[model samples]
Target: MQGDVGFAQQILSLNLVPRKRLSSCGNDTSLCDFSEMWYGVILWTAVSSLIFHLPAALLALFTLRRHKVARFMPIAILLMGIIGPLTGGVLTSAAIAGVYKAAGKTMISLEALVFGVGQSFCIFVISFLRILATL
Candidate 1:
């Protein structure tokens, strides 16, 4: 049972690591290259989440008057702000890890987790501010 749980965690970890892409210098031959690539992964996910959340927030604001769940908008948005980054993290990480794995390389999960949390925090701050401004 413990082994099964560990295996599941390992699978999740694999998906949480970032994908492989050309570093800022267009090469993946050094640790610096990998770091730069990871930064890009983080930035891409962060920006994507921001783009999605902003429009969603605006739409919710406009529809609040007619929606039955008007009162729940704040709570819902708050929840999604938390969940969105996590979902994005898993997806981006899995995609990147898949690429790296296909090329016979490994990414450190700890770095993934740290960057994911940082990304989530950044998204949360920007989203909160944008929503507050809209309201």
Candidate 2:
């Protein structure tokens, strides 16, 4: 979770255009401001989701070399890897929000939550594939 929080902070610091220019065009009845922020956010979520699970995926791949250890450990590791990040993201977001509140800032950081949910989606898809593989 800490790692994920750090990663999010790094991304935030990049000052990406979409994120940096949120809802800039204010209340023009005729003009439509369809910002591509959603696209950037989606891209970020997808990439980060894969990256967050890369370690577990690598470990699972390596464990495949051993017969006995390979049987269940890989799947368990993958599942736990997915779950740990989700919980970590939630807790980290909350902690950061608390800190901001204490500092008299009204900002609420949801990057951790977004990253966690994105990774959770990846895990669900993988688990579904595994189920299909068994059948």
Candidate 3:
């Protein structure tokens, strides 16, 4: 049973790997290149998670400590991370809408910016969640 669980975890980890193929950078290369590529990828994932996401998650968790369930912290971080940008954009837009309205120039609407950011943010957060699940 334990072995089965380990196998399932391994499968999940393998599935989480990006499907994009990377060509070898050198001629006459062997497993070393392939191994190195995956090593670099894993290292990059860890480094990015630590550098970009961890602090945000920590801040979200800290803020949520007052009014949230512990398990909801991760979801809260994802939501807060997204909402923070969107809210800022909305506030800025409300401030600038009049200027744009008067200028009659081409500029993205605040709703468009918020929606675009939200869609991209969801993809990013899902990928991070997958990475965490593997770990």
lDDT of 3 at 49: 34
Model 1 over residues 1-135: C-alpha lDDT tens digits? Answer: 545667535643444324365543323322233443355456445545656566666677777857786956855764575477567665665566457656756444444444555666666687679989998
> Which candidate's TM-score is highest?
1
TM-score of 2: 0.37
* Model 1 lDDT-worst window of ten: 24-33
Candidate 3 structure quality by residue, lDDT tens digits, 2-97: 555665345334423232355233221211232333332333333333345557777767776677467467676666545643554344334444
| Shift of residue 35 alpha carbon in model 3, Å | 0.7
> Which portions of model 2 miss their true places by more than 4 Å?
1-53, 106-135
**Stretches of candidate 3 above 4 Å error?**
1-32, 68-135
User: What's the number of clashes in each of the models?
Assistant: 1, 0, 0
- Tens-digit lDDT track for model 2 on 20-132? 33333442111112222233333444445556567766777786756775656656666665555455544543454455446643321244335435545765687679989
Number of the candidate with higher lDDT, 1 or 2: 1
Error of 2 at 50 (Å): 5.6
Q: TM-score for all predictions?
A: 0.39, 0.37, 0.31
What lDDT score is found at residue 59 in candidate 1? 75
